[model samples]
Target: MNRYFRLCIFFFFAVITALPSQTSASWQPEITIGLSQGLSGVHLSSTSGVLYVYEDLESKPILELPQGSELNVRILRDQIMANGQEIKGDQLIIQPGADGFIRVNHAPYRGYITLLKRKGLTVVNHVLVEDYLCGVVPKEMPPSWSAEALRAQSVAARTFALKNRKRHASEGFDLCSTSHCQVYEGMSAEMWTTTEAVNRTHGEVLFYKGEVIDALFHTDSGGMTESSENVWGSSVPYLCAVIESQMQTQPWERSVSLDALMQKMEKSGKPLGTLKEIRLSPLSIGKGSGDRSLSGRVRSVLFIGTTGSVVLSGNDLRSIFSLPSTLFDIRFRGGEVIFSGYGSGHGLGLSQWGAKELAEKGKNYKDILLHYYSGVTLEKLY
Candidate 1:
């Protein structure tokens, strides 16, 4: 096996075997994520404990650093050193203080940290997976929502984290602290409600055929959830279309000037010179009438312009116009193109608003998850 693959395998085994079982007891799995990049230097501190600095994952420490002593790290061509000492070898490991936080650039992260130079910057935050979820839950979904909705979001986020653990493996980390993975604000974003949700659903994940499924979610679904085939072209049985609620008409509208629309079209490489007219396939309120997805989202559109006409997919239109979703109708009126639509995000997986509505009407998080995800079982994996 290659050196990197061996190292990853070792790491995975270390994490998995470190725990007695997937459930029954809590396992503090280390999740390394890229926090920021292009940073020339970083400042770190811990409140208590004998902070040990190590070269990579070596047994011997380079320095048994003291607590509360701020270490300002600077990156050289390859090595990152503090106190004019060559501390970085392979990677730099900074163990956190006991029951305390590791302060990075003054912001505190609730675990030990590993610093590696990448693209001329330090990258890596070795945090406990549960602690990482604490940072992610609130930012991904509101803490004030119904308890069941928050719990549903917690399970979804946890499943997504574990399933996509190697999403940024080439970057020397598991995930990124942004929407690219999950919006992990670390410590500051944690709230009581979200924390409770995470604890209650500890180690729980959505499973399909005994493996963790991609528990994708969004802000709202308008009234109906979208199928994975319609959005990403790969259909997961659990991500099929469903009417989220009986009450429809969650309206959202946006208007852009003809010039703005043309500029966007030009930027997208499909320059329709002077705008002539936009022809949309007929659409209905719920069921897609013409050239629309089963959930009523636009499938394709024809842009007729003075220079040339271009046909674009609904996704392309959404991207160029900055529309909330593909489920929209285009109307040209008085030198402006107005897009009227429902929904906030891609409309796949569990909808936060839909979950809230269901929770309010006596649905638990498991029920909400099953309703949105089709056939799936919730399994507790410590």
Candidate 2:
């Protein structure tokens, strides 16, 4: 062998050895999803679609256990397993399933479950809350929640699940908890609408380092959510708006003549309307962009569904806002952002309306996640 060639081979191996080993296709099969759903069944979000079922434990009903049974079992933290599915972990992250709530471990965080006695069975129902709306699922979840926030959550869940289906895997879901991504919990079938949103936005995709990542999701925390990447520092999406449409259309909106407004330009020849109003709009107003106010002779247009206010500057007839790459049905008006943005979550990654669409579509929880988020995969952690 040539001495030079041997040296090159050694150098090549050294570089290869220094690189991180890529993860191969995972072969872990699912064991079981654990949650405390009774005959009423539980719900789990999946790429195939929304699934519902129930399962109960053969062990003592936490509530009805004969006095002595209570002694055998203890309420450690506020959690209990359901459907007789044995779980060995600090906690189980359950998806409401067709047989019952499916159990999987993401991470033991916060929230509580209900335990009571009815007849001979010990009733256990885990009220899992994978903080979909607020910031990282806090241990003490706020009692009062915004219906709109929940809707964003449904969209996130569906988008996440749907992308996994495209990956063509059979058993496992992407971890839906922790800061690495958003959190999820299947406490009831009522959230089926949430899953429907997932299926509707199917086949959507995204890439990291050009490799497909299971899109993690979350509900609206104001107009902010997690971002895929930043300065390589944060692990969440920053506050931004997902534009849905263009062409501002409204009989009333059209009634106000832009040409006429331009005709009213100042004698100095400067455009009269310079984003004339500093008014406010609904946080996520799909109602014609937002509220329009009169600032002197100028028109101040307020936008809905954003974290904070941004001023987009242009020569004329333009609206600017920051977004990832794709432009989904968002309407932008031309001007400079005068206000600051607040909170982080998907303004449009999962629209509140989108969540309602999920529910109306008859999609289960899993189905909802698969719809909105694109390009990614799902895995289950036991």
Q: How well does each candidate superpose onto the true structure, as a TM-score?
A: 0.90, 0.27
Candidate 1 C-alpha error for residue 28, in Å: 4.8
Q: Please write out the lDDT profile of model 2 over residues 341-365, one tens digit for every residue.
A: 2222333344333444444556543
User: Predicted candidate 2: what Cα RMSD to the true structure?
Assistant: 17.4
* Error at 195, model 2, angstroms: 6.2
Local distance difference test values of all predictions, in order: 0.79, 0.29
Show where candidate 2 strays beyond 4 Å.
1-182, 188-212, 218-242, 246-382
Clashing pairs in 1: 22-382
Pick the TM-score winner.
1
lDDT of 1 by residue, 72-173 (tens): 788876677775787535567777656567778888777777777776565577777788899999999889998999999999999898888878887778
lDDT for residue 149 in candidate 1, whole number 0-100 = 90
